[model samples]
Target chain A: MNRLNGTLLRTSLRRRSFSTADNVDGNLQGSKVQIFDRHLKRKQRDRAAWLINRKDSLVNTVADNLLDRLEDVKKTFPTTLCLGGSLEAIRRSVRGRGAIQKLIMMDSSYDMVKLCKDAEKDLASDNIETSFMVGDEEYLPIQASSVDLVISCLGLHWTNDLPGAMIQSRLALKPDGLFLAAIFGGETLKELRIACTIAHMEREGGVSPRISPLAQVRDAGNLLTRAGFTLPGVDVDEYQVRYNSALELIEHLRAMGETNALVNRIKFLKKDTALATAAVYESMFAAEDGTIPATFQVIYMTGWREHESQQKAKRRGSATVSFQDIQKEFGAGETT
Target chain B: MVRANRVVEISKTLSEILVCPLSKQPLRVCEKSNSLISDAIGVSFPIVDGIPCLVPKDGKIIEAEVSRDGDSANTKRRYHQDGTGGS
Candidate 1:
C-alpha cells in the first residue's frame, strides 16, 4: 500500500510540474487557448469561403494597397512575420522583395495552414524562407526578442486574448523591431450587431448574436505601449461595401472565414427566434439602394520594442526612490 | 510569505493550464533547478516565490521537452486520488 501511494504521489508531482512548466514558456493553453483557437478557425473558414466564391476580384483589388504597405515594411525590417496570412496574398505582396530573411506564418487551423503551404509552394519565392506553425494569436510559439518585425492582417481583433497576444508580440520583437497589423474596427458588422440586438430585444428581450470584437484605433495604440512597444503609431480607415442583402453580407463574412467563435457564443438559438431575427435583419435593408453596408475597419500600426537595458535602468531609478519617500509623498504619518 | 524572486514549484494542473507568455507553448517546471522549460524555444525560466518569472530577461534556455510527454494519464488519476491536496 505504501509503495502504491508513493507511486501515486510521484505521478501527481510530475504532472503538476509539467503544467507549471508551460507557465515558463508563457503559452496559456488552457480554456483561453481553446477559445482563441476556435475563434480563428471559424473566422478563417468564413473568409476563405467568401474569397473563393467571389472570384478573387475583391481580394485582388485590395492587393495593390496591401502590397504598397509591404514594400514600406520590407525597407523597415530585415526579418518579418505575418500572422494568420493567406499564402497567396502574402506571396503576391512580397514577390521580388529581397530584404526579408525568414517569414514565420502562423494560423490556428490545420486546413488553412496546409492551404497556405500549398499555395506558397506554387509561388516559388526563393528569397524568403517560410516556416509554417499551427498557432493562434493568443499563444504564439516563438522566441522572445528574436523576431525583427511582426505583421498581422485582419486577425488580431478576433483573438480572445488580445492584450496577451499584443504583449507577446512586443516581447517577440527585438528593440526597434516593427509591429504592423490590420484589424476590423468598431464599424465592422455594425448593421449586423444593431439588427441582432434589436431583434433579440424585441423577441425575448436580450443581447443579439455575439459578433466578433474589433479594436478601436486608440485602444490598439494603447495596447502596443502597454505591451512594451515604443513609438506606437495607429491609423484607422473605414471602407464601406454595399451588399445586395443583409444575408449576403453575413455570407461574405462567413466565406472570408470570419465567424463568431467567442467562448461565450450562445449555446442555443431557438429556431423561432432565429427566424424572427433573420426577418428583422431583412427588414432593415434600405429600400432605395437594396443594399446593406458592411464596413471594414483597417488599422495600420507600427512600433518598436524598447531595449531591456533601458527598462532596467528605469526600474532601478524607481527603486532608489525608497518606500519611505513614497509614503512621505502620499502624506502619511511622519517618519519616526 | 511568498516573496517575489523566490522560486516555488507549482501544482501540476495549474502548469497544464498556464502557458509561456512568449511561445504560447507548454512549460515544464524543473523543480530541482527551480526553472521552467519551453520545449519549442529551449528556454528554462526560474521561479520566484510561488510565481514563475517566465520573462526571457530572467530565465535561461535548456533542452526541449525533457519532462512533458509520457506522463499525462498517471498524473490525471493521481489528481483524482489525492482528494483535497491535488490541484
Candidate 2:
C-alpha cells in the first residue's frame, strides 16, 4: 500500500507539471523548459469561475481601455476574433458599436467559455452573433487569412511562446486585417512580487518563482516586426488599484483567475509565510490610509497583415526636403 | 472539475466558422452524434454550453443526445434574429 501510494503521488505530480507549449509544438518537446502549465491554469480558472461571475475590476478596466482604441478606426470588421477578453465586459461594450459583426471568442477554459451564455443575454437587440471556442491560444486553430480583426486583452502573458503566438495570429488574419492586444507587462504586481520574495526567503531561507515573468515594454515593437506585421505600433499604460490589504489583493487575484500557474511555482505558501508576506507588503507600500496599491502595466500591440491598399513608406532618397534643412524649414514655427 | 463526455447544443450559425483545432479544416456535425467532426483530423470535438471545447488533451465528452428543442433551443431563437454570415 505504501509503494502504491508513492507511485500514485509521483504520477499525479508529473502530470501536474506538464506544460502547454511542448504539446503545441513537437520540436520543443523534451528540449525546452517551459514555465506555465496550461492544464493547471485551466483547472484554476475553471474552479474560480464557479465562485464568481466576476467581471474583474482590473481585467474589465484594461479591456475597456483596449476596446476604446477601436473608435479610431474608420471601418468596421466583418469577423472579429476575441481571445480571452472578459465576456461580460466585451459583450456590453460592443452592443452599440459597429466594430464587430461576428465575434469569435476563444479561451482555454470551458467554464469561462460557458459564461458567454449569461453574457450574451445582456446583448438583447444588439444583432450580433458570437461563437465561443475553448482553445489554447498557442495552437490558435484558426485558418490562415480568415478573420478581419483579432484582439486580445490581458490574455497573452501566460503563453509559453508569445512571439510564436503572435506569428500564428498574424498568419490567421486576412490581408490588411488588424491585430491588437493588451498584455499585462512590465513590473505588474511589483510590490506583491517583492513582498512574496522577502517573505519566502525569511521563512524558508530560499525562494522559488512565485510570480511569472512578463514581456518587457522595450521588446514590444520588435515582437510585432519579428512576426512580420506591417505598420506596427506599441504603447504602454499603467493602472493602480488600491486593496485594503495584500491578503485582499491575493483574494482579488484568485477571483480574477490570475493565480500563479508557473510549472515550478511553490504549491502553497505556509501560513506563517503568508502572514509575513502581508506584513511585509504593509510596511513597504501601504499608504497613510492603510491601503496597499497594486500597479498593473498594460502593453498594447497593434499591427496589420500586409495589404496592397495599406499605406506604404516612401523610398529612402525620394523625400523632397533633406534632413539637413530641418532647422531651416521645419524646426521653428513656420515649418507647417 | 470538468466532466467527461458532455454534449452541448449550439446554433447552426456557430457551426459555420468552427474549424478543427488540429487541422484547421471546417468541422461538420455528425447529426446522429451531435458532435463536431473534423474529417481531416478524424477527431470529434465536444461542446459545453454552446462553446466547443477544442483542446484534445482534456479528452472527448460522453455522447449525449441533444435535441433542437432542448438546451440549444435558446441559442436557436437568438440566432434566427441576429445571426449574420449564415449560409
Candidate 3:
C-alpha cells in the first residue's frame, strides 16, 4: 500500500508541473518556442462541414460588428490584407462596397486558404478583386507599406509571436493606414477552466493545462504601442453562449479548432476525469434553464499608422489657462 | 490536380510580392521545377499543391559546391539546362 501511494504521489506531481511551469515563469505570454502545431491546425481546418457548423455563428456575429465599425470610417480603402482566410462573412460584408479594390486573404493553413479560394469564386464581382494565399502571420510575405488596410478576425490569438506579428502588420500598411482586429481575451472560457482544474485536482490529485493563455484587455493597448501604432483603442465585449451540457461546449470548441494546443499540455485525459469535469462544469455554471453558460470575451482593437494629415497631440505644458484660475471662477458659481 | 492549378494561377500575382521568409530577398519562380528559388540562401521552396511551402524546414538547400561563388555560375547554367532542380 505504501509503494502504491508513493507511485500515485509521483504521478500527481509530474502532472502538476506542466500547469505550474508558466506561473513559475511569472508570465503567460508565449516565447520563441512554438506552442501550436500549424500542421495540426491545418488538418483540423480541412473538415469543411465541421468548420462551417462550429464557426459560422460566432464568426458571423464578430464580422457584423467589425463591418459596422468599418462603415463608420469616412475614407475608403483601396487595397486590404486579411490575415485569416476563413472570412466568408467578412467577404459578404465587403461585397458591393466599391471603395475596396483588392482583398488578399492569407492563412497559415493550406486547407483554410483552399476553402477561401473556393468561396472566392462565389464572391467574384467587379467591385473587389479577391485572392487567397497560404502564409504565416509571424512571417508575412507582404511588401512594406503596400496595403491600404489590414484586418484580422479570430486569428491573431493563435500566433506565438503576437507582438512581432503586430509589428509586421504595421509595416505592411501604408501611411495612416487603418488596422482593426478582434481576438479572444483572458476572460474567455473562465467557467470551463475553473471546472476543469477542480475536476483534475479531485480525480488525479493535481492539474494539467487545459486551455491556452489568452491576452488581457490591458495587454492589447500596450502591444499596439510597442508595435508602433498611433491612436490605439482596445475594448472588450463579453458573449454568453448557452449549451445543453458542458460536453456540448467541448464539442463546439473542437470543431472550431480551439482545443488545447499548448506544447506542454498533457497528451490525453482519462475518461473518468473528463466525465467528472463535465459534471463539475454543469453543477457549477448551469443556469435555471438547465443549460450551461460559457463566456467568450472578445477584445477589439483599432490603430492607425503615422501620417501628416492625422491629428497630433499638443506639446507638453502648452496650455495657457492655470488650474487655480479655473477653480476660482467656478468656485463662486452655485450648484443648480 | 485542380487545386494545384489554382495555386499556380494565384502564384502568378503572389510571386511578385512574396519574399524569402528567412533572407527577406525576392523569390524567383522556377516554373519547370515548380519551386521558388531564393538566391540569397540557395534554398528552394517547393510548390506543393499550388501553395508555396515557404516554411524553413520544408526548403531544400543546394549542395555546397553549387552554392559556392566559384561554381555558382556553372551551377546556374546546369540548373537551367536540366529541368530537374530541387532534391
The candidate, 1 or 3, that scores higher on DockQ is 3
Candidate 3 clashes between residue pairs 3 or more apart in a chain or in different chains: none
- C-alpha TM-scores of all predictions: 0.62, 0.78, 0.80
Residue A10's lDDT within candidate 3 is 40
Highest DockQ, which number?
2
> Could you give the fnat of all candidates in order?
0.11, 0.66, 0.32
Question: What DockQ score does model 2 reach against the true complex?
Answer: 0.40
**DockQ of candidate 3?**
0.38
Of candidate 1 chain B, the 10-residue stretch with the lowest lDDT total is: B4-13
Candidate 2 TM-score, C-alpha based? 0.78
Off by over 4 Å in 3: A1-33, A47-50, A124-126, A315-336, B1-8, B11-13, B68-87
lDDT of 2 by residue, A1-336 (tens): 223332543454355347555455543112244657888888877866665544567777777777887888886888888886454566666654645878888888888778765667755766677777888777676777888888887778877667767887898899989998988885789888889889988999988777777777887898899889999999999889999988789888787678888877778878999899999999999999999999989999999999989889878889888676876766767664
Position A48, candidate 2: lDDT: 65
Q: Model 1 segments beyond 4 Å from truth?
A: A1-67, A73-76, A85-88, A124-126, A307-336, B1-87
User: Backbone clashes per model, in order?
Assistant: 35, 2, 0
**Weakest lDDT window of 10 consecutive positions for candidate 2 chain A:** A1-10
Kindly list the per-residue Cα lDDT of model 3 for residues A204-319, writing each as its tens digit. 99877778778778879998998889989888899999999988898788766677766667888999999999999988889999999999999988999989898988789998
lDDT of 3 at A159: 75
What is the per-residue lDDT of model 1 for residues A1-336, given as tens digits with 9 covering 90 to 100?
Answer: 223332543455346446755556434333223233454464465357335443444443444355456566434555666776443465556765537777766665545555665677677656776655445566564566667778776667666556667877877777767777767776776767766777778888777336755666767787777676776777766677777876677677666677666554676777766666667766775556666666676776767777544333354456657787888788575654
Please give the distance, in angstroms, between residue A330's alpha carbon in candidate 2 and its true position after superposition. 12
